[model samples]
Target: MAAVLEPLPQPDPPGAKTSASTDASHASGSGLKPIKRLISDSRIERIVPESNAATHLQYCSQFARDFIRADYNFCAAKVTVARGGKIRALDAAFRESGEWLGKALTWIEQHPTRSFPLEHEVIELKITHPLAGRLVRCLTQYDRIFVRSMEVLLAGKIQSHERETLLLNAGKRLKHIVQVCIPDNDAYLTDGTRKTK
Candidate 1:
């Protein structure tokens, strides 16, 4: 699914003490909407056989990769547009990006493998899946990047050079993640036998 790009409530004005009502409004704003599931149980059952743990892992990884890609693209577009002397707009985009990043991390943490039945049988599959682990770490890094960026933006001390640098770093990271997630890439995949490196 595409990342939600609804308008988020503006942050409190500079030098203004944030009030309780403002905080409540922000909580109920579009920036903090409920997270959508990355993969549904019914979809998993339809696409992956119960006995095929490897395929399930592959499906989960692909879904996560797609979601992150879409989110990154959305954030990039917002940042690009906001670079045209729109600081408040940029701040809103960063806040929205942070929300999506949190959702992605949560989804990764609650990977389907962790909830699969026959724990003993799938324990190794859950622990040993390189793509799943790598995706989690990558998303964590992204979360950190966005949090730091938002801090700078919210503090009203972000310089143009600093914003450019952050965007460059984020783009580089996104490229690395996309490379790692390529389904046919031998670096992250194996022969059709479900062998993991």
Candidate 2:
């Protein structure tokens, strides 16, 4: 005759708290009330608008220059690859250009104006500014072009003529960006006197 074995203990049902467990939780201070966190107000009470504007303008100008350089390098790489140049050269060019693009994109993403339906007046001001918006748009377009160039370069399936067309389009965009950033010196006189055409 074999002795009968006892059934194994089952886990407690969900939401069913035992007295020992509850006592242990209280002992561990888990039952204490949560402390209130100090939250700062969203108002821009202390910030100077003029200083902020100047800083943003300076940032936009610098970013525009960097973006132009990156685009130029990437386009150069594309052109080189398209002209039956070495892949090694294209790889080096792409690596440098990619670094610049990455930094620009990160800055754009972190900017307060990046959020939609601007709740703050300061953000609205930046987003509406001509230079700020223009730079953002140019950088965004450049990002798309960069992706396409990478795909074409890696796949190596596109014809040489097709690559040339892509390069031409990129060059046109780059030219437009450059013209916007750097106005014609002849158009603006250095002195107060107007230049006689």
Report clash pairs, candidate 1: none
Best-fitting candidate, measured by TM-score? 1
Name the best candidate (by lDDT): 1
Summarize candidate 1's per-residue lDDT along 1-197 as a digit string, tens digits: 22232344577788988777766664443233222322232322233222222211211222234444344333222222222223232333344445555554453343232122211100111112323343434544564444444445455556657755654655455554333223332322122222256
The lDDT, on a scale of 0 to 1, for candidate 2 is 0.35
List model 2 lDDT by residue over 6-91, tens digit each.
23336899998678766455432423222121111111222222222311211122222344334322332222222122222233
Clashing pairs in 2: none
Give all TM-scores, in the order shown: 0.34, 0.28
lDDT of each: 0.37, 0.35
Residue 52 Cα positional deviation in candidate 2, in Å, after optimal superposition: 4.9
| Candidate 1 wrongly placed segments (more than 4 Å) | 1-33, 39-128, 183-197
Residue 87, candidate 2: Cα error in Å is 42
